[model samples]
Target chain A: MRTTLCDRLGIEYPVFGFTPSEHVAAAISRAGGLGVLGCVRFNDPEELDRVLDWMDDNTGGRPYGVDVVMPAAVPAEGSAGDLGELIPAEHRAFVERTLAELGVPELPDGAAERGGVLGWLHSVARSHVDVALNHRIALIANALGSPPVDVIERAHAHDVPVAALAGRVDHAMRHVDNGVDLVVSQGYEAGGHTGEIASMVLLPEIVDAVGERAPVLAAGGIGSGRQAAAALALGASGVWMGSFWLATEEYRRGMAEASAMQDALVAARSADTVRTRIYTGKPARLLRTRWTEAWSAPDAPAPLPMPLQNLLVAEAHQRISAAGDPSVVSMPVGQIVGRMDRVRPVADIMGELVADFASTVDRLGTLR
Target chain B: MRTTLCDRLGIEYPVFGFTPSEHVAAAISRAGGLGVLGCVRFNDPEELDRVLDWMDDNTGGRPYGVDVVMPAAVPAEGSAGDLGELIPAEHRAFVERTLAELGVPELPDGAAERGGVLGWLHSVARSHVDVALNHRIALIANALGSPPVDVIERAHAHDVPVAALAGRVDHAMRHVDNGVDLVVSQGYEAGGHTGEIASMVLLPEIVDAVGERAPVLAAGGIGSGRQAAAALALGASGVWMGSFWLATEEYRRGMAEASAMQDALVAARSADTVRTRIYTGKPARLLRTRWTEAWSAPDAPAPLPMPLQNLLVAEAHQRISAAGDPSVVSMPVGQIVGRMDRVRPVADIMGELVADFASTVDRLGTLR
Candidate 1:
């Protein structure tokens, strides 16, 4: 499983796992793969600092990375209060009405707010970069687009490589032009915000366009060892996987949200997902639930762009989730969710990936 | 370059080329690859018979296949006149107005209607099957969906293997259940009618779902040897290529329509294509052009269903192509068009694919 990318990153395998749970991140790194902790969910700087400290301690000197959502085009400037004000009355009414229709109860008077929208803003993302840079992070990846030039320079100053996710060749080229150390070619089957191209086409296009400048990582719909081998054969340096980690024991044990999502994911198939903007005001692939369908109704207003969309649904999602309604929970996942049937340890998952990749390569060798 | 599938099909390389031109098909078979002639353009059974005879005579006893678009679910029963009447006047007006606005000249009197829509109907597609089975075709492929059970049985009785193009895992499974000998997993990046799933996700899913029952062919976005190697690594028995042959000299010399489409395809990038229902009523990836954009405008009527939509635009497409206006032409192509920069012979393309596959396999072998 050793490739140039594995050597550059000092990992035993070229598998890069992305998740929001620090325990899962630490476990993956300790298991010989590079684990990237997603920082977008940690709106509080202090909490992010604590998570990084925990990751640093538990990784036992194994290298890990941090991922932040830094978009090339930021939405209009606004405070949380200002953005909340942008939600239309009808949209608010629609959310409340749909929750009531679904028999979802409201949160208790003193219940903690579970969803936050501030992290999606550019200012907060830049702060994430600051916190990540202060740690022993070996990589800093912009989840949405190319990290700002200043952010890239700061990471380079710390001798940390910078990576960005691109769905098209032009976007990958833009990242290369802006001095990104790596480009993750994400296909439409990937979870969260994605462009229309698929990985089989997008990976090779980006690889050919910018493989000379920097290595490209293949993402979206990759879950097993054979997929990792296929990614390498398509000219990608490694595989960046996310949804596969959701089925891991470490992730489910560390986060309650993962447990809730696992129940739905186990029952889902590849056709059970739909790409809609109801979750974050961007086209994200999520399990097809009543929540997504309600927003897709003919009478529903167009989803607001970016931060405003995330803001409008934050409270509604909190209430629904707090009520323990699995039917309406927002589970951001990819088409690969169909293959995630059971929970296993990070070590076991990593072992299977390396073994499967080796066997696939051997099988290819048998081809005349 | 050889695999069990190649041995089963008696082909030199596990490459299957799909094209509409008989000359191109024969050329590919003569060049040591299996060439499947697409028969959807032949609305007349006699014309299809003549073409199949030509392929049989031109290829020096080499094996070839025939492709027909026999959809599993035929549209609501109706004659050509009944379906024609179902098309709204406003839709017809929109096509004419858009073509005139683009300055496409009308076809000359008796200009031999360059395009036809009858082939998309179920009856015409069945006729295509009847014409093909009478010849010595090694394979019979359904381009749209699983062939009717009777069609599959008939093909089997003739000692010809049946294959179907599936864009989803469930669809592939269904094809296997209906007794298909092979499944071609096509992704969204493919030209013509395609589902939303990308090849990276779709290929492995189909392979895992039906590899035991049927050999799976990776389709969509494959144009080179490295991709072929990657597809095999992902568990495909072979590769089914379409758009790559459009740039070949054989296809260009064989069909005038191929020549018209080549101009737009050579200039297209991966992002330059759009999946729209304007051309075929089914969502098909086409080179983004004024013809597509006009129908997408706010005032444009909703595209009619299946045969109706194909009927509405067939004459307009004929007129546009007759004018030799590449900007407004309807060219069905895949994202791989970005890599097809020049014309080459069938032999050279096959040789390059073989060489690239071998070198990629060698490179993968170097990974420790």
Candidate 2:
């Protein structure tokens, strides 16, 4: 169980949990798995430093990682100029007008309302990466795209491994070419935004594509050890989970929120968790909520381009965040929701998955 | 395209292509759109006489249908049987000895020679429904699971429409309970044996499971015109294809196997298809040639379950009927293979499909 991955990240079980919550990262690492803090939401670099310090203090020497968005296909080269100059005025107007028409209320006090979408994401994520790489981070993962060449070089300079998330073979290929140490094949089942491919097929393809160059981690929609095993069977060396930890005791979301997640009947076949630009203006797969419903209306303005989309909805997201409304809030999880019937401790879940995987492999052995 | 499919039998699109090959069914119907032939490989009562005769003689009537095996799940309820009663003492001994020893010739053409791993599939698929129904057969579909019950009832009762081929979703709900027009959410790529689930994601969660309703036509790894449009965006009225046809002057395998099929470099990664038990004694997915070496080793009798794992080296499978050299055989057509690069008589393909389906649907659509 602690074989290959342990050698790579130098962790016990090959479970890397991605979360915005530092508590989760600490808890998982303490529980024998590495929990990487997803850095997109943290705007202040110092906040990241503080969070890392907290994780270090809490995890008691258990190693952890930091994940940021380093997509391989971001605003390609020159087009990235200003990111604003790149978007059409018409598109911008449409997005603004749609918000005006929707009467989405204004943001409350103390909100840092200045530099729009791209500005925020760049400042926050890039800064977090810089801070984490400077700290005791064991790994740095790029969520959206491949890490900029400099980021990879710098991380390498520090002896920290760099990982990236991929939804397709081509995406994974680019990351590998860019020299990612590991490629986390994230399927549609995981929370947040995801590729259309399911875990069953995407894993093997990525594993094959990576060949012997880099280790591969299976991510998205994995809520159980049985699934973790399936990923291994498909050739992934470890499991990267995001949604499974949503219910852990350390998960600080409100009580009602956690209860809804556990008790609600979200069938796998409902219209689908859309890969819409409702969130960061980037394509993301989240639960279809009333907020998303409003934007999807035929009459509503098409979601603004990345950053812009996030800009328009930022306040709404913040309000939901402050208010803790599950009905209209987006919950990122994968298709693996089908198996998340109840909540359990991080250790228990990890142990069960390991045990189940062993049993399943044995079952498959019997077939042979 | 004047291969009138429906007028005689009665349905609509006339795009029938859902079988593993059924004698002359494809040739007969591909001449127009009237008949589609899959599962003719079952070689039972329906094959030798009824299906073949119908395929050869059907006029500009309608699209006829064909169906092969595509499972919503591994070990689909009826897809493969325990065959516990069928396995001869020697076969069991061979299976045991294979694993007990190092490399034993994959399942020794077990005593009965009566049934290979896919042995029960046809009978299970005999789902006479693929053979029943007709109403202009605009399109003949394969209800991969039990071929839609209503198809049989409606086709028989009204003398119109019946279909098969739907790889995932609640097959019981879609093909068994609902009244379908056609349903085959084949993967993104595949030649034979599918269902790891990847029309990226469409194939599995396809909206096919309302029960006793809808005809399903799932063809994976298709290589052709408007296929992406027809299946992904448009929800195909017809499943136009490219694999078997690629081998055909009239069609296009379009992707990897378009030329040498079993002997292409693309076949290595492409041929490790699942939907096991189709050709093998057990269900498994192995590289067309390279990956399967271990299975065929003289002492390694170990194979996967029914159709798949066994599909590679099952001694008794007519598996080599298509590839010839059992050890080097390859079956690489899949949904993603739609990327294959070629074209054939889409018209002949379309014509027969519509023609047979028209007749099939006309015969069945009219049912009470």
**lDDT values, one for every candidate:** 0.86, 0.54
Error of 2 at A6 (Å): 2.0
lDDT of 1 by residue, A245-346 (tens): 887889866556556667777778877789998877788888888888888889888988888888888888787666666677687889888788888898
- Residue A299 in model 1: shift from native, Å? 1.0
State candidate 2's TM-score: 0.58
The TM-scores, one per candidate, come to 0.97, 0.58
Predicted complex 2: CAPRI docking category: incorrect
Q: After superposition on all CA atoms, what RMSD does each candidate show versus the true structure?
A: 1.6, 20.0
Least well predicted 10-residue stretch by lDDT in candidate 1 chain A: A252-261
* Model 1 complex DockQ against the native: 0.74
Model 1: how far residue A241 lies from native, Å: 0.8
List candidate 1 stretches off by more than 4 Å: B76-79
Instruction: Tell me what fraction of the real C-alpha contacts between chains A and B each candidate also makes.
Output: 0.71, 0.01
Per-residue alpha-carbon lDDT of candidate 1 for residues B73-109, written as tens digits (9 for 90 to 100): 8875566677778888888788888888999888888
